[model samples]
Target: MGDAHVDSEVRFEVQGRLGVIVLDRPRVINALSHEMVNRIHAQLVAWADDDAIERVALTGAGERGLCAGGDVVVLYEDATSGDGSETASFLADEYRLDAYIARYPKPYVSLMDGIVLGGGVGLSAHAAHRLVTERSRVGMPETQIGFVTDVGGTWLLGRAPGELGVHAGLTGTLLGPGEAIALGFADVLVPSQRLPELLERLETEDVASVLGALAEAAPDAPLLDERPWIDAVYDADDIAVILERLDELDSDAARDAATALRGRSPSALAVTLRAIRIARGFERLEDALAQEYRVCRRLHAAPDFAEGVRAQVVDKDKTPRWHPATVAELDPAWLDGVFEVGDDELRFDIGPGTSGIITGEHDDGDEGARE
Candidate 1:
């Protein structure tokens, strides 16, 4: 009923009772550009008022479905020429939408399929039901792109159990469905081949039926099965320790991860680790997002973000001249500066509202006693 006729990067459909939103930029692995964010917000608002749209189930087009994240080239261009206002503006709007999704009414179902990374994780992680498939290859590789995982990732990852949060924070390594679900980043694991049939069933079933079928869906990856790497390196309290361990390991994956870290902007990595650590005990999704916003604003002004992005994306060269030799060489004062507010901010005086529970509400702010 509302502006569904116009064209956009996203497509909206009603499969019986379920309102399906598909991310359609298959050219970029369905990456979420700024225009896509606005389209998503508009459709969500439209769906909120439409009585026919009983529930929303979101996914991407093509066989490799779901989303990756914001196009970095767009962000880099926006941040060019000492005018980062556009990029900052994009972060503010995107973060607000993320907080909204985390606190939305009705059932929010996300098919966490395909390359669900940076911006993609922002969309799915906050939903009422998170369904990962064999295709899901999830991570927040913002550090590599000279960006930190904003959009409430710091808060969400902070709330993740143990040092795994910090592990994801620093290295920006992606995880498979098995690893992601084991770490509680995803809720259910379904085979990719069966997802279409399940979505069809969900279009007509009651909420109970939808969830039961999802629960009954076979887990394509067994997360709880032994994953030796996460427990070893990810278990560290800080990035320094994690890097030290990574340096020690002689395995190809370990060496690759360490080499990748060496190539990233050292300042970005340092700030990212601190952001995740400080994100502990955030009371609401907004609070966590506020902190992330602060870091994003300061990140570009620092040395690493631009250098990292230029080396990786713009220069078409794999080499980045990271300032520090290792995580240890990162200056303490510079690292602390990210959390400081020197005017710019993303915040609100939002009143208490009940949305569905996320992975965070499982605790009673008892992270300290356990950690």
Candidate 2:
């Protein structure tokens, strides 16, 4: 099932009772495209209904790990294309797929082996069985790209224990398997060497048995000790306040965190803080994604996403000329405008004859109150 222009980058096949999804884009570390999202979503739906398929296992093609993220270069093109409708469509579809993975009934196992981030997190974090190997490095690095964590990043990151989510959201820090597990972003940690054997055994064995047998003991999370520091510095609701707090601390970690925020797009930092704060209240993952959709609808038009992409990806220059220059100069209303949208929202089609879930409210029209 390839898209019109290209062969299928995603390989979906059945091996005995196991339904497997192999992301086959080693060139870009398997960064997801809109076509990949649709194909993967369709396959998931097909496998979900197939009684012969007992479980699902997803992994990347090469050693680079699952996925780097979404194709932001394409996103940048579409977002700034003057007609951002395509970008919006892509976000809605991507989020729908993410929500589906969140609620997927069967054993949805994601092998997060290496360099998993942004879109990568969306694909694997919500699954029932999120498997990571020692080589895995995962995070939501959207802040650097002039975007908040879309693909239900708000829901996934917001729910992490304490203010760890805040630290991750603002800084775009990459975490190892141990750190990921400590942050609740990953489940079992399997050794990189054992992954091949584990996959072989998985074809014939139950997911639980295979994981239980091969899952390696995770090392001590270096960040776990920094929880108090993270909670202290990231406690503020405002990014400015958080930065001020970080600057006040004398520790090198605090200095590093502050420097990291200084380098990101100021607009993205503000929008990300607000998104995560509001997301903390949503009960359903769909609700959080909907809010993210509202932000994304207007996000592309902002000067930062394009400029950020140009400096980081297109031009090879590390300097991004972010509008307003600093967080204090950024208008609150601009960030507010990102969240304002009409009826155009994300809708999740679970299956045939099954209705899609609209964002913001349930069919009964009552909002699922956030916790």
Candidate 3:
């Protein structure tokens, strides 16, 4: 085993042929910072070129989870005090990292052990080998913070079977391993107790062989049973209509979903709905990321982004006063602007063994407990 490169928040090391990265901030559930993102990106780029490192694996420290999400508290401060430039830079770099992960050449394995949400999903879900444990609780809970899902969430969600992605995004529901795999966010379920052995085997064996031997059959996903209602209710692009359909269906799950959507930022819900629809038509993950970047850039200037974070994180009030309190009050023109491509857009250097590049010469640029 090689000596670890230890950042305060993240750590990297090489063990035999496996390069291991650990999210080390267990106190905050390993919430990611901009520095953490950059460090991980740089390390991944380096490891991609290292012939000695045949595979890379990511894990979070502590018992709670791999990552809770991004450090939204910092974002709240930046959005309120700065000119949105700082937030824009963070998004740019974060999205670029996500694009790179999606295109990584070497086997990238994510141990989706516990609470993986928002940016956590970005890190793990895009990997070539995504291993979820029975303890895994995965989701794109961006709507809870008055933010539309990013970090390639729209791409993942857009490609989900039926309307599972739409329901998950709009409601910000946390999914168990079964639901996560059923929704296509995860690949296999490995028992939590067996993870150590699995990692040990990775030091000598290929990812496919180790995972194939240790992976267990996932538990039943109740969400799968609800697909008929989920597809029926969330099939439309309009949030208002979806809510109406949820109410009209009159099932417990449908009503519950409706209640969940009602509490989130109206603008976030609307934008998420549209983003997923558009992402469904995209040919590549990069395209969805570029679209999400546009929507997220616009969202930084919106009142709900700050307000939602205030209520959810700063105050713990759980009552955000959305600028447009209702979906009906949302301005169609403003929504259009949210998806419009601006001077700064996210672009990737598309090819094997390449990382993403941000284009348009703009300024540089979380998850659940805090997504």
Worst 10 residues of 1 by lDDT: 362-371
Over the stretch 177-237, how does candidate 2's per-residue lDDT look in tens digits? 9988888788879988987787677777888788889887887787777889899888787
All candidates: TM-score: 0.85, 0.92, 0.95
Which pairs in model 3 have colliding backbones?
69-366, 69-367, 70-366, 70-367, 89-364, 89-365, 90-365, 366-371, 367-371, 368-371
* Candidate rank order under lDDT: 3, 2, 1
Best by lDDT: 3
| lDDT for residue 50 in candidate 1, whole number 0-100 | 73
lDDT of each: 0.71, 0.81, 0.87
Candidate 1 wrongly placed segments (more than 4 Å) = 1-6, 214-238, 248-257, 349-371
Across 1-371, the per-residue lDDT of candidate 3 in tens digits comes to 66689979999988888899999999988998999999999999898788898888999999999999899998899889988887888887888888788777788889999999899999989887888998999988889889999998998998889999999999999999999999899989999999889888898899878988999988999899999888888888799899888889867888888889889999999999999999999877778888888898788788999999999899999989988999999999999988877777777665555656654432211010100
Residues 255-279 of candidate 1: C-alpha lDDT, one tens digit per residue: 8777776766677777777777677
Q: For residue 6, what is the lDDT in candidate 1?
A: 29
Sorted by TM-score (best first), the order is 3, 2, 1
Model 2 regions more than 4 Å off: 1-6, 349-371
